[model samples]
Target: MAKASVNSPSGPASVETLTTRGRKTRDALLDAARTVFEDVGFPEARVELITAAAQVSYGTFYRYFESKEDVFRVLSDQLFEDIHHRGPSDSTLSPAQRLIAANRTYYQAYRRNARLMAIVEQVATFNDDFRRLRHDHRHQLIDRQARAIARWQQEGLVRQSLDPEMAARAMSAMVDHTLYLWLVQGDEANEALLLDTLDQMCLGALGLDQD
Candidate 1:
């Protein structure tokens, strides 16, 4: 029902056009669902509320998602996809450089989806469905980063003693906690504070000397 525009070309124009349209529809529905969920929470965010907000009918909603949990799963997966490309693609930048890029993307995504993050955090605490859904996505992201951290350690970009799994978990915790605090409390999620905090934690965990 709504159109989303793609300005910069990343691939063939025709394919990009199709992708832009599909992405827009999904994003619109997700955004609307998040808003309804934030206002009414997981238990009360009915399909009607979401469909109404998205200006779509119940049939349209089902065409895109089977259930509310399905949408929530999509939301978490989309968040991870937004953060990392999850491929062994080449990057001209070093590992640390790429990590910084990923961190920035994560924070920006958190800011943009603050309401949804809040809803997910609350639902995750007591709801097994939400918890399992969120946990699965998080585990995948952590594992991927762990592999990258292992590579960085082998290259001496990180300290030899830093356990990649532990480092990945710590990084995930930091991002989650930071976002939760900002979103739940309406506090300013300062970029500098986030960067400084993450940098310090990473440096300490990796046993790197203070720069």
Candidate 2:
């Protein structure tokens, strides 16, 4: 979406340029914004509510953020960072085991940020900027997985007939959509069973020999 124009001569201060105290205040506003967005969503959320939740004033809010959409973008960036984190990889694990571990880690991250993700999903429906942001992040993830699948295929781990990028995209959709259904849509699910099923489905799609 088009950014709301700020009246300031210098515009919103970059996070790097903020003083220690300024960073604290900005962080407070971000924390408050996340809560407000999760509780009331983007359309209903107002700067006043965020400032009130942060125990700050309108001047303080404007000092850190250009507008509500700006703060939401910051929060969305953070959420994506956390979701994108893969942590340390264990080289000793088999490809199949690593895939399961990756799925588990992703699922856990999704569950932790499920509330904010729901809000992001809602915002993306009509907001072009957010829609592109969401799509770009997903594409990055798929690209990484496709590369891994291609490597595994060369190593004779995954089936030669499968297209790496297509398999990655399809598997990603399965996991992502399933989590949205269970977490965002509040579909009842048993965690262990669901994750195991997802792991199995991904492995099966790659035609990997789990033996």
Candidate 3:
């Protein structure tokens, strides 16, 4: 059976004709690739390192992935999925509560995947496709948040004067950059204080503090 297709530098590539055992092997290679990338970064990472880490032959690596970059794309896709968060769906909760819950979820996910995130950050600096992928993912989050803010504004839960998209972008940057510093850059922080302050800042920016 065909596995999910991922974009390569040349074009889209599919992992064609995989059995149950083949799927396990492919997953092993991906896990090893993630470890290697996190340990040595994208530029230093090699197929041999991944194969060695996976305990698979170098030839086996090519069966699942076309190249190092190909496997990295798959890893990046997984990282994106891991980090993607949507706000709480409980309609009974107040807007402020939902926002706080969403922020908490995002922070927790970032903490769990900080190493991979750092690798992706480094790769995005030099790789055009990775850079675009990173931006697109961030923008998707921002757009969703913007729509939420607009809805809150319509409900009179947010300040009418604030532009939803701009506010969303600024608030998203505040949360994302702060997490990068604390988690990826190893900045010292009190976890409770950091999260609480982030919640307050997000609320205050939207005028939800009044509620």
Candidate number with greatest TM-score: 2
Instruction: Evaluate residue 29 in candidate 2 and report its C-alpha lDDT on the 0 to 100 scale.
Output: 98
lDDT of 2 by residue, 9-71 (tens): 788889889999999999999999999999999999999999999999877888889899999
Alpha-carbon RMSD of each model: 8.4, 1.1, 4.4
lDDT of 1: 0.70
Give the per-residue lDDT digits (tens) of candidate 3, residues 90-169: 88778898888888888888988999999999989988888998999889888989999999899988999999999999
Per-model TM against the reference: 0.72, 0.97, 0.90
| Least well predicted 10-residue stretch by lDDT in candidate 2 | 1-10
- Kindly report which residue stretches of model 2 are placed more than 4 angstroms away from their true locations once superposed: 5-7
lDDT of each: 0.70, 0.92, 0.86
Question: Over the stretch 16-79, how does candidate 1's per-residue lDDT look in tens digits?
Answer: 4446666677668888987787788777878789989998766666655656777776776666
Backbone clashes in model 2, listed as residue pairs = 1-129
What is the TM-score of candidate 1? 0.72
- Model 1 is weakest, by summed lDDT over 10 consecutive residues, at 1-10
Better of 2 and 3 by lDDT: 2
